[model samples]
Target: MNTSLSLLADLLKTAQKEGADRADILFIQTQSVSYQIRNGKMEETESSEQNEIGLRVFLGKKSAIISTTELKPDEFPRLASQALAMAKVLPEDKFSDLLEASSPQRLSKNLELFDPTLPTNDNILAYITEMEEQALAQKGITNSNGSSAAYGKSHIILLTSNGFKGEYQHSSFSAGISVVAGQGPTMQRDYATHTTTFYRDLDTAKSLGLQAAQRALARLNPKKPRTANLPIVFDPRIAGSLLGHFASAIKGNAIARGTSFLKQALGRTIFPKEVTIMDDPTCKKGLRSRPFDAEGVKAAPLTLVEEGTLQHWLLDIRSANQLNLPTNGRASRSPSSPPTPTHTNLYFKNGSHSRTDLMADIKEGIYITEMMGSAINGLTGDYSRGASGFMIRNGQLAEPVAEFTIAGNLNDMFANIGLANDLEFRYGVNSPTLRVHSMTVAGA
Candidate 1:
């Protein structure tokens, strides 16, 4: 065991003996490595470190939390006193509960979160530089793109008064390239991706660069758009964004505060029957996988929406207490801010339609490739957004298009949206190629 961990555990035990009905302590340690290449040269390479801990105490109906970077015995009592004082002044909260429940039984394994033999910044830069050189080889590519790669590792532990103690560690890495093609009025740009929990999962630099160049060249001929209520096909990347939209709708905090559209829609069919949404924090190799969440609550897979029917809303300790339900282990805390809600590896299940097959069904609809601007009301479910992509002609991808607005009420979009079998788990929230019918398309 790490020496610091033992000392912290002792500190927590001491806090429990100091007249508090319930208490919890969290310890966080993190490190990051980042490399940036500019103009075919290594521009930046750096690392960061973070070490902090937080403590929460409960007294009767009131509760408060305090955190510090200092890890001394004299500071603990002062921090506790400050929290107790603050708890005395705040109004009684309905969601404040001292949880004494046991955790779910889960198959546990030690996940490998560190690779000491991973390439260093200099070696990684050499690879990125080589990639840019390859991208510039494309005939129409006017300017080669630089690449940025980052790796991060975080370790966290949680100890609660009710006999729950847990810890988890994880790692993440991402690489991206931006390419410019053509010249003057024909100038256009495109990008490509490579990201994973392990270094081995990334694509080679040459492949990544070529993909970026090919994507940019595909947008050569711009097409004009028109105002029509037609089916819009969302590529896998854009489709995944719907998960965030759903996350907002089912946040217990949002519902309790009367700020969520789904607040009054529990047990109702919120999305199509084929659209099943899950919050999985233990997905193998998932970037957000963990045994626990930011607040140290045990993490388990949750079905937020299943088979079109509303199921569960995300909950933190506070919100769960108020609802008299188990916490979902989804909360975040910063040095200056209190605990708040977040998601981990929220995924939408795949259907039975591929991207090519799905697009072939759209005769004259828009294929949204990129989304811009935010125009969704979290509380009302009203949605409108600026989009850029391509237009479909005769069931085939036709001319490139840009600067269009797609407007629809999310409450309606949910019920009418169709899922494609092209589901991909690229980033955090992943969905497949999605088709939404009869959205108001504003184009000239």
Candidate 2:
């Protein structure tokens, strides 16, 4: 047994002896290092290590949760007794209970989630310096915001009185660069970043730096368009936000509270027939992949949307009980919080058309590369946000544009979505280039 599992097992026994019907515990440890460089000099370096434990006790229909950073063996009895006392006073929550015990299946296939080789501080510093040097070497690049590299590892152990015991460890590495282009008042800034579970899978520092420089140079001088309704194409970098909104609307808690725009759309067609969205937790080396969810349920792929129709709501035990549905293993939790529904490795299926083909038919359109602000109403599906990107004219990308707002209801936008074949899994929530037939663009 893992050290954390042994500790949690002992704690659960103490809770039961203290008048708790059931209990579950989580233990986590994380270590990280980050280094940053700016203007040919090291700007900052940081290192952190943390260990936390959380305990949840249930007495029939009531439950209470508590977390602590103190892990002394003598403190376990006090912590368990405290949780039991809190549960006794809390109002009954009929939806709370431990998951039923079953033979827990360990991951048979290698997920490639961890890399044991830890990068030294010198290695990280070298990466940041190379990235900064490459970005500064670009002709139009004038200044740099900074370049950075980070590496981290996390270990988790979950135990329940119902007989579930599991442990996993994963590591992550990332590199990024941000640069300014042009001079003085006309300067524009852009950045590029990449992260991976395996250090070897990270993109080259030079590639990331050059990409940032080119993007910044492209936005040296931007124009504002006349206010009008136009075809809006979302670059792959920003297209994932659309999917994020969709996921939020389909969360089980949102559905139970009638707070989601998608509350009444279950089993109905909510998008074009060609659109399909999926949440997969089993992809090899996926950034968010795990053998099981936070609640001890086996993690599996789920089709949230299939052929334009809503399929299933993301759910955890509590939210599922609220809706009279089964848990779908979408539960995610931190040491200090209870499990909640969250998507892992979510993405839209790639479309058959290339990006050029998707935009070729539009005589005039906006290609959004970035977005800011949050003016979305989840209950009504109304979407509005500040945006910046380039203009598409005569089937080609034109000069950059900024200082604009794009507005539309998500329902209307989903119905008109046109997808392109440029999907990449660089982000956990990923999407291909997408085009919406028409939307209101407010600009000068």
Candidate 3:
């Protein structure tokens, strides 16, 4: 065992000896470097490193969590005693308990989660400079907002009083550019960025800069259309927001607390028969992949929605116990926080129709590429948001539109959703182009 793992194991043992029935320890060390450039000059540079340890102690049905940056052997006894003292006075929570004793699954050697190669700080700065230059070279791109490149890696270790013990490491690389187009009152801004587990998989700086410039230029002189009810198509970039909303609504805590719009939606046809959604934590090189949950439960794929019916709620041990359901291995946590349910690499299944085909039948509508602000009622699913994109007229993209509000109930929106075949796994939450039959577009 490595030094950190050995230390964490000893910490758990100390907690148990200090009047605790069960205990768990989590350790995380992270290192990151980032560079930012604007107007062909380096504006900011940053490097960070941190290590933290969290201890959780259980005394019968009462448990308490504590964390610190101190990781010395002599500190273990004090940490254990402090945590147990807190647990002793806390009110008993029947649902809060460790998983039954079981061996944690070994992490796969071929997870492809870490990249050993590290780019020099000079290389990162060069990339940022090139990104900014490319954006400024484009026609009508007047000013650069900024360009940035970053790399980060994290090492994680977990140990419990039971048989569970595991560790893993993951790395990330990302580059992005944001620029303004036009000048004065008509200026518009847009950005493009890509992040990947391996440095080689990131999009080239030139490609990202050019994409940013084109998006900004396309939005120059945008107009607000007349108010009306019309079909609304969502570009892949913004369509994922719908899936995010769905994920939030189906979290186990939301369901158990009666706060979710889909609280009573399980096993019901809430969408079209063709719609399906999945949360997969085992995808190789996935941005959010994990070998096990924070509670040491083995990770597995889950079908959240199947053939229009709600199939499962993402859950951790506590929420699952409250609902009298088994956990789906979706628990996530930080060193200082307790476990909570969250999805990993969530995506909707692709549909047979092309994006063009989905918008071809619309006489007049909007295609949303960006959305800002939200006014969603989680309990009632009433959704309203500010939107910007292009007007769709005669089966083709027309002039750009902005400063509009779209309003509808999420339940109604889910029922009317139409998926397109352009799905891509570019983000943790992925989706294809989506079309809603009709909505109130509050434009001037």
Candidate 4:
């Protein structure tokens, strides 16, 4: 048995002796190294490792959680007893408890999450420096905001008093560069970044640097459009934000508290007939892939929206109990907090039309590539955000625009969505280029 598993089992026995009805524990160990370069020089380098353990104990209807980096075997008794004592005085929460159903009989197949090739500081520094140099080599590229390369690995172990033991490991490699174009007040900036489970899968430094430079050069001397209700095209880079809002609104806790605009919208048609969305925790080599969730529950694939209808809410054990629904195994947790509902690898499906075809009919619109601050009303679905991008004039991209606000109710926006066929899984929440019809654009 793993040393951590033995320690956790001992802690559970200690908790039982302290009058706890149930308990669960988590162990996480991580190692990471990163390098940052700017102006053709090494600006910073860091390497770190962490070992942490969290314990949660239940006393009837109450529970308490605590964490510590002290992994000594003698410390288990005090940590377990302290958690039980804390649980004794807490207010009763009828809905807070472990899953009554048995653990999944079988775990999912190996997801190939780990990459054995570790990164050396020397290699990372070289990689980042080269990335920055390439960006600064561009004609109009004035300066570099920064360039970075990083690699990390983490291992997790979970155990429960009622017989659940599981563990997994994952690795990550990432690189990015941001550059400025032009000079003085008219200068603009852009960045290109990519992350992957395997080091070989990362985008080349030359490609990323050039891409960032070109994007920044495209944004010089942006003009603000006159305020009007016009079609809005969301670039694939930023379109996933819409899916994020949907995830937040359908969190089981939000629905249970009646704080979500979509609280009462379940099973209804929330999007156009062609729209479909999915959440897959078991996707191979996915950024967020995991065989089981924080609470030792196996997470199967979930179709959140199918053919326009809202299919399910993201749910954990407590919220599912409150709403009288079966837990869908979406629980996520940290060392010192209780579990919460969250999605893993969420994305909308692609549509039949090309991006050009999707925007061909729009004479004037905004093709937003980036967004700023947010002002979303959960109960009302009112949405507004600062934005910057290019103008769509005569069915083609025109000069860049900035200092504008896009405003619309999410309910209306969802219904008006028109998707393009260019979808890629570059992010945990991915989407194709999409257009929303007739939204208010607040600008000069």
Candidate 5:
């Protein structure tokens, strides 16, 4: 066994000897470096390295967790003893238990999650500098907020007394730029970013900077349209928020508590038949891809929504047990907290229409490129948010618009959703450009 795995196994043994009925250990190591440039100068450079261990002990129905950065062999006994004592005084939770043992499935293919070509400080600084320079050179771009480049890698090792042991490592690289256009009261700001598991897959710094500058320039001199019920389109950049809200409304915990708006919508058609949402944890080189969840359960792709019908809830072991269902392997955890249900790489399937095709028939509509604030009621699915973008007129984008509020109930919005074919996996939770038939626009 590896040193970290051996250490965790020893910790689990110590916990068992300390009177715990069950136990698990998690070890993590991370390293990261980042560089930022502003106004043609390198403004900051930062780096971090961390190694930590977390221990969880269960005494029948009671459990407690403890964590430490110190990996010294002598510390295991004290950590285990402390956890056992804590568990003794805690209230029993019927749902808290380790997963049953099963034969582990080996990955069918390489995930390509790690990139060994670590960029030096100078390389990161150069990328940021070039991005900032490119953004500042754009016409009408008055200043730069900043350009940044970062790289990070994380290693996770999980061990449990129930014969589950797994370890994995992943890497990430990203670059971004934010710039301001126009000047004074008419000034507008926008940003662009690109991230990838492989260093070579990241977009060029120059391209990112140019995109940011162009976006900011396009937003100069904004106007607010008259209040009315109008079609509202979401840019791919912010369209994922709609999917996020839907994901939250179907979480197992919320459903179990009867607090989710989608709690009673299971097996019902909640959207157009063309709409399908998915969560996959095994995609090669995916940002959040993993072979197994934090609980050592094998991870697989889940069709959360199939043909517009709610199919599954995001669940962890505890929530699944409470709901009397099997886990979907969505459990996530941190050193200081127990496992919780979370998404890996959630996204919607592409639709038949292109962005232009979706907008072609809308004589008047708001194409939302940016959103601010959140006014959502999870229980009712009532949604409202400040929005800014360009107005779509006669099948073309025309005139910048801002300072407007879009309001609708999610149930209606989902049913009315019109998706475009421009889906890209730039973000972990991604969607193509989407349009809603009608929404109340609160504006001038």
Candidate 6:
């Protein structure tokens, strides 16, 4: 058994012995390896490993959480006693509940997660080299910001007093390029990347580099968009960003705590009938798919919003306890914490209109190729972001533009947004070209 697993079992046993009513133990370990290439040469290659264990114990309705990276045998008992002592002094709560349904039901796991002794560092570097060379070959391209690849093999274990115990290992990779394009007195730079759990699914380094090159080159002749309140088209990447805002409103934790901007708006026509959003943790070969969440509960497909009505909120053990709902396995943890409500593979369902047809009648509008800055407010759903892209004049991409701002409120945006058929799930979250009827487009 893994050291972390053994530590979790020992920690839980000791916690129970120390007079806790109930408790759960969470163990985590991660191995991260990375390779970076700069200016056509390998800049750095490195790896790191770490491990930790967290204990959550309940004394009456009060619970306390404690963690440690040290695995010494004596530390377990001391940590348990210390946690109980703290819990005893804390106030009781209505939402406090010990882990239950800790045992997971048998189900299919994400097969794409991990494999031992993956292709050596040499294999990854070779591919990165190819991508860099491809970008340098592009005309008007001079030097590069860099090309890089990263991989992580992470393992986690969960154990609870209610007889639930499970562990899983996840493998992931990220690759991309940053290129600089130059013309006589002008230079522009940009980057693009793809992250996946499987190595084979990544785009060729050359393809990745070329795309970055194209992005940089497109800015060479950016022109101002014709000022107007016309409809706009958002590529899938940008569309997905807008959809992400919806997740915050659907989070049960957020809604119950009165922190969400979407509170009390349930049961009403919140969005257009064509707009539907769902989260599927079991998406086959999906980058964000997982067999089980950070909490040891059953996970299945869930529609956050169906058509125009709110469906359900994202929940974890903590939030579920407050709402008196069943465990939805929506929990996830980083290297330093325990399970919390997080998404699996959340995305908007693709629509049926093609990009050309979607933009057919629009005489003049902007096609936002990229958005800059984090200007969306989670509480109010209001959004304002710096942007740069191309102008659609008479239904054709006429000129590139930059140094502008786009602003809108999410409520109004979703109620009137239109989705094109071109939506593709390039990531776990995706949407087609979306057209927000009218937004304030601040010009250069």
| Per-model TM-score on C-alpha atoms | 0.93, 0.98, 0.98, 0.98, 0.98, 0.94
**How badly does each model clash, as a count of residue pairs?**
1, 0, 0, 0, 0, 5
Model 5 compared with the native: what TM-score? 0.98
RMSD vs true structure, all candidates: 2.3, 1.1, 1.0, 1.2, 1.0, 2.1
Flag clash pairs in model 4: none
Q: In model 2, what is the error at residue 140, expressed in angstroms?
A: 1.3
lDDT of 3 by residue, 330-406 (tens): 88999888899989999999988998899899999999989999999999999999999999998799999999999
lDDT of 5 by residue, 30-141 (tens): 9999888889877887899998888999999999999999777898789999998999999999997899977766753477788988987777888888888888998899
Q: In model 3, what is the error at residue 108, expressed in angstroms?
A: 3.3
Model 1 CA deviation exceeding 4 Å by range: 101-107, 110-117, 334-337
* lDDT (0 to 1) per candidate: 0.77, 0.90, 0.90, 0.91, 0.91, 0.79
Model 4 quality (TM-score)? 0.98
Model 4 CA deviation exceeding 4 Å by range: 101-104
Tens-digit lDDT string for candidate 4 (1-444): 377778778887787777779988888889998888889777888889998888889988999998988677788778888898788889999998887647444877689889989877777777887788888888999999999998999998888877888888989999999999999999999999999988888888888988998899999999998899999999999999999999999999999999999999999999999999999999888899998999888869999999999999999999999999988999999877899999999999999999999999999999999999999999999999999999999889999999999999999999999999999988889999999998999999
Residue 246 of model 2, lDDT score: 91
Candidate 6's displacement at residue 34, Å, is 0.9
Candidate 2 least-lDDT 10 residues: 103-112
Superposed by TM-score, candidate 3 places the C-alpha of residue 299 at a distance from the truth, in angstroms, of: 1.2
Model 4 is weakest, by summed lDDT over 10 consecutive residues, at 100-109
What lDDT does model 1 reach? 0.77
Looking at model 4, residue 117 earns an lDDT score of 92
What is the RMSD, in Å, between candidate 4 and the native fold over all Cα? 1.2
Error in Å for residue 334 of model 1: 4.1
The better candidate by lDDT, 1 or 6, is 6
- Kindly report which residue pairs in candidate 3 clash with one another: none
**Regions of candidate 5 where Cα sits further than 4 Å from its true position:** none
In candidate 6, the residue pairs with backbone N, CA or C atoms under 3 Å apart (3 or more residues apart, or in different chains) clash, namely: 102-164, 103-164, 131-205, 353-421, 423-432
